[model samples]
Target: MSSSRSRRVEYDRFIPFRSAMDMDYARFALTRPSRPQRDGSRESPSSVAYQKLLDDCILKNRSRILAFKTAPEAPASKLPQFDEPIRPQKKQQRRIPKEPERVLVIRGLLDDNVLNLLDWGSNNVLAIGLEDAVYLWDAANESTKLLQPAEDRGPITCIRWSPDCAVLAVAYGNSDLALIDPATGHVVDGMEDENQAPVLSLAWRSNSILTVGRFDGTVVDYDFRKDDMFICFYNGHRRGVCSLKWSGLSGRYLASGGHDKLVHIWDACMPVSRHRPRQRQWLHRISSHTSIVKAVDWCPTRSNLLASGGGCNDHCVKFWNTINGACLNSIDAGSEVCALLWDKNKSELLTSHGSPNNQLTLWNYPSMTRVAEVSGHSSRVLSLAGSPLGGVVASAAADETVRLGLLQHRYTSDPKIELEKWCQMGYNADTF
Candidate 1:
């Protein structure tokens, strides 16, 4: 925590943020609204019915946070009586389309033990790992090509783009990790875990540092620039870490959820290794979910706000205000929450689900109201990624198809998008 609020600039003013990982993730996970947003802006209803419901919500939940505002200005002198009083009209928000604008049919989505998530690069490229290969698809033109074909390494477990958008971190089913340049497809660095267990999840802490959560229940941090490489070790989680997300704020908090049905938040400042091993080093050991916690994300704008989703058994999504390890809000999702993404441009959140609905739900934040639902995937929706320009979101499902939904059409040139699905993972099955 900073000493004063004055030190904190407005959100997205990360030109001076200390950690590169914080800046990188904030840019990648957030929606890039082209229109400049004024500080303490207000939301206006576009329709009467919606307005009435919104007003009701405001009245019912008076204590809930709806919008941030500054002090009201001193009132001007009463307007002189006129034929009709002129009033300023509120700008209404553009409604996000309910249907997906484009769809891509590709297979091998159920790659061996891999996380069901994709990453969007600063270059507007979407990285999707098939059975054993990593493919990059350009969202602008819908052209895709194989970036890496690691047949012998086993199926890809996880792929993440570095904060600077220069290198791609790839994890394999064989527990092999590598950093490769997306431009030349050259392996910049590679590492092999002593334990044969594969990496269940991974997140880049910075351009040079990568944290890996393994099936063996080990969390290790590697600094590729160092001669030893493996610089730190974090101990926790009795079971495999299914999801890992480094807080994209100060890079201080590391949140992870796994098969153990527990979510843990660790402080990077607490470097616990074998030599100086400390018990219960985590800042918070959250036991809120009854089942596996696969979906977890740090709020893009709020440093202390974190969201987590539970598995089928629990079917719950919880929001934590990390300040005192207190639960701020919890919602029971009808289906299993497979993934969570926050719409940073607006006070909204998006989640992908499994089982009953396999649909993507858009939610209004603080209010915690369902705004829209997008259905396209025939199976479980595994991954969710937002475009860098902020209009569309890319989702991958077990149905072996990737669908792009137009969230804020006004942020893009048009709402019409075309995607031709083509992946070589099916033919590369032998690679496993």
Candidate 2:
């Protein structure tokens, strides 16, 4: 076979061009003039056919090589033009329902520092300070107004608002006792006796008020309309009384706890005709706490239940039954229980701690179990109160910051899962 005709098969299997030099050289060699055709003789038909075949093979092979090398020149199909679909972030909201705004008002910032506070019914909050001033806090608007008399005595240590929320009784230094109207800020009556050193606590039941002094461990009861001031004296505590609480369920009965580590229950019932009301009888005294009792409160829902804390530096919380004055249980809070409060619903016991560390602990009431420990204050925690209608809790500290927080509880509903599935379709947790 002729050399040119035989080369056609080789062109069909052309090698791919790898470099620019190889490609250019191959094209140049194919186009260059063939060797002097056999002494310039006129080529025969077979030679012409062979020469045409060789040229055609060279052209086809060169085209295939060039096509292989330059194939990338054409613009790529440009990957489907996709924009990563934007994902929307989910907004988080509180789990509980929104509640009304209830505020705590600062009545008077006393110079000697305010030590005690009492809520007179649902309308008024009583605060006593070292400036010989008695402050009546308007609970509705969270504001404070003074209610001191013209003959203002010494700094008040104890204050009690009548069950009717109409009058206030103040117990102060120099063994003085006075009754003042909270609304008009006027003193209706005043009495002084040298029976006790200084009154530390005051409690009111019906129309009579209960007062306890540091000089004697006496719980003195006094009536407003009586000519002579004297009620039955509770001498069960060997040391001065520190705190007192009257049961709202049975206004005629009360509870008192003091430094003697004893809690006494009393019953004050007098005939409606008695001009000078008689004394209340001491029903029982339960000695349970190892140290001084700082504060005592009757459970709002449970008629016979009471809670106490303070001075028990080792174990700071305790629950008891007022019926028999028997302690139900105790909890070790690792500090002095400066203040103890039962929530508005009486389902929780909030305890405040003093120096070294400031903390607020929420305990399941009566059961004596802790539910949560809140820590954000740099100073001692002084007071704690919860909203009546909401899950919000307010705590006041010596640090001057009143913290407000929601009591968070986890709840699951069937709708939540269905909604999440509909929203998340093909996505997962990692997509967030």
Candidate 3:
């Protein structure tokens, strides 16, 4: 009956439920759908409005829905037609030709003597020094003629043709050097030695300058134009100076080897007055050889490159960079390397062997691979010379025979081609 009690009773009556369990029936009745007016009934206003809202959303986002189904692709190039013509690739061929023919041969050269008696002249004439006689064989006509007949002086020790091939420098056992006319076969000039030792080796620097290697281990350069006066004198080898070569490419460097097991590279332009009594104009005193160093030659193409071979005790072919006196390469020749000749047209080297093999080997220089081995001499092969016209090599042996044969040129044809091939394989020139 109080005022607060009357307000609480009025609130409870308006709310109609005192707990959640009392409102469950009303909540279920509200969620239940109304009965349809007929079998095919129309949609309610709220359901119609929700359907219309979905339709509106789809119409507004039509481009976005269609964009996922119709994405653009990358453009493609047009292909060739089926009837188009195709091009063919070209094939490569070998560069070097086949082996050359064996031109000619001469027998009974020195009667089984191991001597440096064979020399090929630029005039296509081959000179052979046999005991007391020196014969000139015309390679073109296949004829032999005596340039110097048997002399009283010691048998011919060495013979070298002048650069012009017009005169011959002959060394006799009587310690005499004679410049003879090849046409007349007569001595035009002569020089007598004081020691009377045999001149074992001879090389012509020019038509006027002649270099002689003596058995007394002396190297003397004589100027024939100046009354055969000695212009330069070098004494370094303790034994006989057996080999001497003036570089044809540089014309300023001279290579000498001796029986003393020494290889001396001399600069001809060096001043002799600057040295002492026993000292000489030797640029490099190379002592790589253990035995007699008899075979020495300058590379025809490389100015500062030199090649030398040791005797039976040391059968090695050594290549030297003469500029710094550095040995570039050393190859065990398996036998005494008696002689070496460089190819004129290719990067090849021909070496003659003695003792066991007695074979003539054609090598790809720098590479040093033996390309061909020719064995015809029954004795020690001593000397080798390349033809001035190229593609031929003449070798002389202790068998008393001179053989002319073809040197293989397969891998030595062109240096540029070899370089290109090496580059493709990741190799350089120094790799050899």
Candidate 4:
């Protein structure tokens, strides 16, 4: 019986354990001898001690054994519970301001087919030419005074205030161009014989040299200081020259529009200079307008950019690259474009329309998006001039009225306001 018991112990020790619990039980059984199995016999003290040790080991390592067991599945919940309610984020809406402020209006001042009847002087003065009279309106005090010529030539045809604001160039229907002092309204100088046709347009190339466009379709550069003598003549347009503008940015290129539906860009030098004998005075003969091309303005920010607007038959504004003579952009302005003005402080274009619309439109440059429109004139709007302070714009219409309003951008230094203005004009906020 002793031999059989020893063999049983060896067989149990040789058998491989399947789990950690089986290994612990085998260790306890092998460390102590087996107890005798008699009817109603109590367990030996050693067996009881071994059983307690095994229980203690399992109790100490209960977590370790369960870590290797498969985890139980979690029950799914239909709705999630939160400490607070969830809210969706709201999108920001863009805001656009209303029409510009109307500061003042002077009625019964303009009543003709004249194109450039209104201009703002550098001295904060506004000049308006009515039939047989030239009025100087001081914007600072809102005062009006008639500018009496030295001699009664004829009804006033054209009037241009000099860049310095001290002198005014006045043209009469009798083919006479006179330089008058604005303070006294007296003629400082006069020229009559050089231009037989009535001077319809006048632009100062310098303090002494003035460019005159005649009703006979001739463009002449004259030195007003030297007895108003002619320097050179540029002949391109078939009909009368109605608009003349010397580029203030370069002072090297001249843009002139005529009643013949032609827009001519001219170089400032002589038509037949010895160095450039083949190079004529006319640089680019832009025949884009189907009707009269009167409104012409050089971009204040871009030196090589030029903007010109057409008449009733062709209600379009075309932007040109002066260097290469390429039409960069064209916008169909719905109505007859009468005048174009660039904002001095921003990259925006203001256009005055006539006839059907008779409105003033502010546009985003290059994009050609209409920002705002002003409408009050009963007749066609004729001219537009920006204030020297860069905040106000004055518009004249054939309804015999002149209106002053604020610009879309009041201050250039405020970027937040400008960004909001652009977004309101249907532009993406990231564009700027």
Candidate 5:
């Protein structure tokens, strides 16, 4: 059986790569007539007959593909023609075009407030918490809040405005959060931390849903439009949450950084019932920082990209691909990262620092280069907020001043700048 199997294999006669020639030859060989000669005599055909058959096969197989091809200009054809190519667009500038124009500077508030409590609303209003009181600074008319927080409502720890500007959510040191009508200064609705922990951070996913982070690392979300209010909670951090930001392609992802040296990424699209809501697990728990993780923000354009910074012990700014929780890049920012903000229309990032530097550093994303650094505060910057218009930034610091900078990166016609010039002149007349 082995000998017969060995003999069954047929050796190839066709040349490598030129399989078409092999196919041509097989067609000619198979078509030859098998003549049964009389008297069991087998004989070769006449040379003329063979030549006649060869001629017939050649004529049958002939086609344009078998014809010769040659370049008529290169000793053959003319040179190929090409249309004029379009030039690529110029790259966006890495640095802020000019130094930040000091727009509106609010001076002389008492020091000692939560470091993660400055937010600029889409309604052109800025909310800032300064020790025991919440202040709303209206940028449109240069008028301060006629509806201010009462002095006895404990110390205001966090202030966030809804996307629609319908209400402002203020969290007190006593773990109570109130949603107040921005125009009327009336507390319309409120919630409290389940554990009675101090609410340190707040992020709004939509005008109706508010995400809260507490001193005990508890994270919860509430839909203000509903009766039950409580939607879901996230757990992972062992210490107080320091910052919270809601960003993603669908704006359903919640990124929270805490004092436990952890960053928890949660998703609200997982679905939670209002009446029987329970603990919702975190999507990703990033433990890349050696110290407390504080400053955190999502890339405005890239949904899966997130950036976070560490406290003084680890002063490193790290970028993460939130889709897979991978550390994409890291920068050793020489000072503590107190807060972070990203330009909405550009790939630029601004970070507020603490300790010796106390400087605000602007960076070009992906490239991770320091574009500009401005020393605007006497002490560490407490928090940062970028205007909804995409060019200005508001930073509050321990210096008890809120400085608005018209980054003026690429906007030649930003109305915020015209408004800034007006506020710069009138800022000193009023105080908060």
Candidate 6:
């Protein structure tokens, strides 16, 4: 039986990739088809044909494969050996964050007193503080001087500088107004008066001064050129009047907000008879704040839009339509607002809280949502202003610092350098 099994085994194969020791593993087997005779006698021609077809198919597939079972062996030779295995090298990488072309900038110092109110006149600004002193700042030159009049009997409550920056109107917590020439740091004249209550807000129309206060709850018009005497006092607000602003675009309309939680619009003009300074007839009385309205400002671009803020005893800043007194939008700041500024270029609303928190919060006007908040001040923030480019914002607080920065960078290039060169050439021509 062993002899018969040995004769039956077929071997024409190659070994698998393993150590060459044990050779009894299964190997490839090659089979040859049995040829048929021309005379088919008791055997089947169909089986022979089928076997030949299967063998041909197997040979065809084997030829297409890349790897083979059998190959000629290489000659033995000595080669260099690497002690370390081939390892892939990793490369170092660096990632950088993108920076803005123009950054939002803010910097400032503390004020000696809790600034009651703030005002901007042309390239200058005024801050009315606790000592009946009105501090004027030259915005372009970054200089400041205190305007404390000889007759200042009470703390300055509010200030308004003329649009042309020719004269500065000062109002004390008590009834009085001082017109000062910042150029000479002297009182202009006829501004000393003690008959009215504290002037809460100051405004200017054509060459005259308009002031609002609690004495009569009326709008008082003062003509400093004609005389120190009052021109017209029109009763408008039922309660104390606290805020007033002129339309920078038209210079024809005046806006005032009062403790009555209403905003009054006045047509600023001289009456036909000139008896009253075109009486402020209270065109629109807007009511949105539940408590006293603290401040109000007319848009510089459009004469029909007004922005107002109130210490939240009402909790929000509101934009109102000047003609219809309709509330357009409200931003919830969650703090008592002491100051608010409208950045014309970026359309951002900058608000400062008086108490509870001394943070300055910036809001996107279009979205009516808070965008960024600065929490560096330890005291209440009283005033805010944005640069023309709208890249930087300046805020004044109970702490005494005036901050300046880029609102937006037109470019890293200096805009003034070229202008300076042109000016030098012009100077040389004039000298010749």
Off by over 4 Å in 4: 1-110, 150-152, 269-280, 412-432
The digit string of per-residue lDDT tens for model 6 on 219-275 reads 777766664457666556887677666787887778777778877777655343446
What lDDT tens digits, residue by residue, belong to model 4 across residues 205-242? 88788888888888888786565376778869888898
Clashing pairs in 3: none
List TM-score per model, in order. Answer: 0.73, 0.60, 0.70, 0.70, 0.72, 0.62
1 versus 2: better TM-score goes to = 1
The 10 consecutive residues of candidate 6 with the worst lDDT sum are 95-104
Model 3 spans > 4 angstroms off: 1-108, 111-114, 274-279, 409-432
lDDT of 5 by residue, 1-432 (tens): 255555565776623444334455556566755555666875566655555554554434343232123313324333222233336669876344343444444553445423466888889888877666667877767667744665656677888888888888888876788989987889999975545888888888888888888888888788878888887778677888878888846797889898889988887667655664687877889887988877899997999889999888888999998778889999999988888888887798899899897889889888989878888578888788887766778888877778877665445476656655644654332455
Cα error, residue 431 of model 1, in Å, equals: 21
Compared with the true structure, all predictions reach lDDT values of: 0.76, 0.60, 0.73, 0.75, 0.75, 0.59
Error of 6 at 78 (Å): 53
| lDDT for residue 378 in candidate 5, whole number 0-100 | 80
Which candidate has the highest TM-score of all? 1
| Candidate 6: stretches off by over 4 Å | 1-116, 124-132, 139-141, 212-216, 269-278, 386-392, 399-432
How large is the C-alpha RMSD of every model relative to the true structure? 21.2, 23.3, 24.4, 19.8, 17.5, 20.9
lDDT of 5 at 18: 40
Instruction: Give the 10-residue window scoring lowest on summed lDDT in candidate 4.
Output: 423-432
**Better model by lDDT, 4 or 6?**
4
Per residue, candidate 2 scores C-alpha lDDT tens digits across 1-432 of: 556654534455755556533556467777876756758977788677655655554333343324345344434342321234435658765342222122233433232212344344434353434345755544345456766544545666666666666667776767787777777877778677676577777776566654554546767666556776565565566777767777877775677777777777776553332443344446777776777776677777788788877563445577776666676787778887767777655487778786667777778755657777777766676555444433445555655445545554322345455333323333221100
Best by lDDT: 1
Which runs in model 1 stand beyond 4 Å of their true positions? 1-93, 111-117, 271-280, 411-432
Give the TM-score comparing model 5 with the true structure, all chains together.
0.72
